[model samples]
Target: MSTVKVNDATLERINELKEKLKISKTLILEIAVGNYHSKFFKKKEDP
Candidate 1:
């Protein structure tokens, strides 16, 4: 499990992107994690 903190400005940007992309919060979070994992690990498979 992990935790993340979002400031008001960042939260607002997330909401704007969510609305523009028509994606749910859960999907957005999954995409974010996927991106982080790929960038940090430099691997397609999860650790």
Candidate 2:
């Protein structure tokens, strides 16, 4: 259980995406955070 705060402009964009995707705001946040983490923090495996 956690919380995230965003500026008005970011919130508006998230709301618009949620409406366009027909999904919940929480889902949008989860996807965004997951993508960010994967892009920046995911570990690479050694061959």
Task: List model 1 lDDT by residue over 1-47, tens digit each.
Answer: 55877799999998899797776767899999999987888764565
Backbone clashes in model 1, listed as residue pairs:
none
- Overall lDDT per candidate, in order of appearance: 0.83, 0.79
Give the Cα error of residue 46 in candidate 2, in Å. Answer: 9.9
Candidate 2, residue 41: lDDT: 60
TM-score of each: 0.40, 0.39
RMSD of each: 14.0, 12.8
Tens digits of per-residue lDDT for model 2 on 1-47?
A: 55876889999998898787876766889999999888666454322
Task: Give the count of colliding residue pairs in each prediction.
Answer: 0, 0
